[model samples]
Target: MEFWRYYRVIRRRRWLILLGTLAAVLMVVYWNYTTPTMYIGKTTLMEPKGQTQDGVPLFQSQMMGTMLDPQLQLSNLGNIATSQKVLSNAAQSLAELGLKMDPEDILAATSVHPERDTNILAIEVTLPDEQEAKVAADAIATEFKKTYDELNNQALKDSRNFIEGQINSTRNAMVKAQDALRRYKEQNGVVEINQQLADSVQNLYLAQTNANQAQINHEAAASRAMKAATELAKLPESQIAGTSISRNPIWERLSESLTDLETKKAAMLNGVPGQPRRGPNHPEVVALQAQINDVKDQLSKTKSDYIASTQQAKNPVWQTAYGNWFQAKVEDVATGAQAAAAENVIKKMKSEMSQLPAKEAELAKLQVDLKAATDTYSLMKSKLDEAKIRENQGSSEVALRTIDPAHVTEAHNNGLLKLALALVLAPLMGIGVAFLLHYTDNTVKTAADAEKLLGLPVLTAIPGSKAHSLPRQHCPEIMDVAYQMLTSNLWVATQNQADNGIVMVSAEPDAGRSVNASNLAVALAREGAKVILVDADLRKPTQHLIFGVDNKVGLTNVLSGGATLEDALALTRVQGLLLIPAGPVPDNPVKLLRSPEMKEFVDQVKEFADFVVFDTPAGVTFPDPVLVASQVGSAVVVHSAGRVPRGSEAELRQRLESIGVRLIGAVLNKVRREDSSSFFHYHRSYEGVVMPQLTSGKKAIKSGPRDQA
Candidate 1:
């Protein structure tokens, strides 16, 4: 996998792995510990022989690619420790921990492993509880070492015993060679051989035999003597071989050393006899010369006798005996001396061997006595390794021990951010979804909503009938704002055309046209205009509630010849506004409104009123708004900003103008307050009545001090 893919796995499934791993770890910990128990234990160990040098620790060079599979050693340690025998021993030891488990069970619970290659073995045993587990571990560790040490000691002792056996034979052979050489040399004769002189040959021969025999017997002797003799002159065996005292170029000097010394002394004595600067005996040179001359005379006279005679025949026995003495005694003595030189090495070996057999034997016995111990130790070590492995796994594969660890909390992960996002996205999505459904929605949300779909204009939006419950007492500021808004819109609709001013207050059936018309009349009357509120909606006459007047004798009766126009016309409670309430429910209200009487009634009211505001049922329900709008000079199309169907605005306009009316503009109403928090409505009032802004903000001016008076 790519690193990022691994990252994603860690990112997305982090929770799964994290939660799972945390649960696993917690379980392990809980299993290992309970009751918040505190536990402590210490373990120590000494290095095995050869594993340490002078008490300094050393480890074998270990690396990844080496032939030594170190991981295998670790893995094996884990495996072997978990073996049945080790488990049993571990169980037995854990008895002190108050554990009642079988040896096998305890071993299964315990773990064993090496502390690197430090020859340090670690064992961990768990009990039913925390203190118990610690105690079990300590017991297992102690017994485990005992078991291992015994086995090692026993093995070492066995090896030492074997080495000791090999050493004896080598010693015996060494001694025999010494005795043989000694006996051969005692039988052989010693002769003084003078190598320098043409002298007694027999004497030289006997001396040769003695020298040859000594050479034969003296290999070890020579080696030992060579080691001891510093100047090389006093050596006995070498002397018998007839070597001169020193090398010299003079022919006379190259002869035997004794002869040379004697010759030189005689010459010195004879030449310088009585010619010394002092007395003849007083010169040190003369005295030394005389002494040497006398000794040489004796050596020459003594050796001259045999040097000639013995030179004629060489003795076979002496030759053969000399050869034997050289080979056996001499070589053997050399061998023994070399062997002796290895004393330190031998002693070291013995010392090591001395420790081995007992250790080896002990190891064997340990195998028998603590066989279960070995097994238990191995098991505990392995299990401990597994536990360590598990602990390692808990660190990364599980995100439990986080840099920011999670704790029990009332808040959720990313909760605040989530809530904020929902607060924003939910509404946005809701609106979008609402709009999406709105396209398929048949009900009206606004006049535009209806018009866009149905191609119609909406007439009057009846401000909902709950009067601002307490009027100014309820909220003057807000109601004033609404009043000003409606009036301003209507005033704009009537711009430059007040004659035949018809305000079509309409909706679909039950859309509250009466309520709309009455308030609009009140609004206009309060504006100082002569406004006539007419209940022209024959299908459902409701202007009576708005006027709070009797509907027993009104438009229906007047038109049907039961009353006159004067009797039907009534002054409403609102100033400058007149009401023409529909007297009663008419069966053919449409026909009555369409009659010439209705036209005459309109003409009459138009003469007296500055604006004729018609309250009509929705165009779809009744045709009064359409009829009046068609006759008027200008029409104010009031559309329920909301509530009206999506296409109602366009449809209402179409209906009004279908009979040839010119629509000045439309008044948008039932505008939402909370839902449309984005739009701000500002207001000011003249007493209880609301006065509309005459123009845009750019055109508005504050009244001067003089005008304020």
Candidate 2:
């Protein structure tokens, strides 16, 4: 239901939505056509495998390896491709090619990125001219490669220089070590130093054997002392000599009570040997058992309070163990002293051995220093050679490779995407506007709105006509049915009332007040009742034109005494229906309608016709309708659907009610097809059935025609 309501709103404002959408689409198309075309040039590069021609690693250092990693290298290359240095060089190159481009412009046009999950970099340049784009892409790539190579080569040069310095330092150190060794040998007269050192080592080994024996004996004595100490710890410090136990008289009395209770319980249960053995359930047995438990608890408490005494004495076994422990500890101390003396002797022997040959020890140390320097010089020399080789071979060619040269291609204009977006957004924007207008529109569009505003039921909703050129009889059957329904509702509302006059009024002009009034009169006349439609709107009358009658003299004439009500009445095409045009424009319709003569005119019309519908101008703007309604004693408000301003109907209704006029409900006039109820859809089924036109022999009344009903 909600969707249908929104659909009706869109349908009512379809032309507005269409125009807005078309304008948006045209704008998008014009923008796309007027936009300049752009050309793109792209270049591709790949990371080097970091392998030398001789199947050796080119970058051996941790830093070098990181700099050459595939992912990291590709990322660095991407940055370099768009760097200021590369872009400036590219701009200069472009200037040479007759394209005076700025570095900023080139930078703005250029984009560099690494391909996902691949050791590849893509550099793109977009420009209006194809040749410029291609040249710029190529220049940036070439410059980036050169810059990268220069960085790598500089690193290699630094490494080579460092290695060369180490080599020089190591050579000097090696020479010094050789000379020091020769001097040490000469000064000490140390010949066959290894043989002399071996003799001194043999003597040191014998002394060490004696020290080991002393250490073993000390360890054995310490173990014995530990065992004796453990046994001593297990012995008691003091021994009990004798002990005595004493019982409490209270405990003895409780025990005797418990025995007596148990004896009585047994007698109660055995029942004197065989007379009658009582069961355990006997009350006497239960009582005796509880007494026994009480006595037992008391005895247990008394036992805990009993006293005990003892006499302490020395333990012979403990004394013997203590003596043994002391003797072992004394022996352990003596052994420890002997082990210390042995250790001291070994230290003295080691000191004597250390003094064997200082020149031999110094010569050995100098020889070790010379061997280390020689090895270091050899390693640095090899590294320096490798660095020089790496520097000679260009770093760029070994570290990076060009996968694809820059080439020209047409850049994507995204015309289709823009067109699609415009197409999609245009309707959405239009719909949004439609809803905005819908919510902002303060008018009655449906019967519900009228009823809600007027606080009264809606009589009927008259479907609007699109063919103004056609005659009224040729109108669609739906409109006729609507008028009939209105007439029926009005009859039911006013059937029991004394007054037969109804003043038709509207809040705004062009609300089809006159048309509704004429149609209602026709509907009532068709029901076999006399009907009179009075165009009381003296300022602007339309009933004459609606019924094809002359408006030379009407209600105004009758009220002004220019003619009687009978003389002013004009016959219409509808049977049993008479029309009274509003006649000449009045200077003051309000004063005339409020006069007593107007009240007399309404009473006369009520007596002449079964129903009298007085057509009036906009009640909200003019007091003519309200004045007429006061004399007529009843009012029927007619409002154009979706055209009456908010609160206008309510104000008009309040005016009528304030004058003590009976509100006969409202009629939603000029309702569009979309706003009509579903019940009205049956008109489509009757579209093929042509409605018969009712014709009367009586001709239309011209000027001065009187109808004496």
Give me the displacement of residue 394 in model 1, in angstroms. 26
TM-score for each prediction? 0.37, 0.60
Q: Residue 253 error for model 1, in Å?
A: 99
User: Residue-wise lDDT of candidate 1 within 1-709, one digit each (tens)?
Assistant: 3554333224433445545455545554554444343332223332332221110000111011112244444455455556565566767766655667787666565556556755444555543355565566555555554454443344233323433443353344335544543454455433232332212222333333333233322432443234333323322332133322432234233246556665444444433212212324647657666766666565544423222122233333344334433433444565455445444443443344344344332222222223322332343344345434443443223221112111111212344454455555544554444445545434444445434533434333223324442111233445545555666666665566656456554445544445555666666666666777777767767677655788887888888989876677676665566677888888877688778887777777687666777767777556777766555545555555445233344456566666777765544455443222212223122334554533222201123232245
For candidate 1, report its TM-score: 0.37
Q: CA shift at 490, candidate 2, in angstroms?
A: 2.2
Give each model's whole-structure lDDT: 0.48, 0.73
Model 1 accuracy (lDDT, Cα)? 0.48
The alpha-carbon RMSD values of the candidates against the true structure, listed in the order shown, are 43.9, 30.5
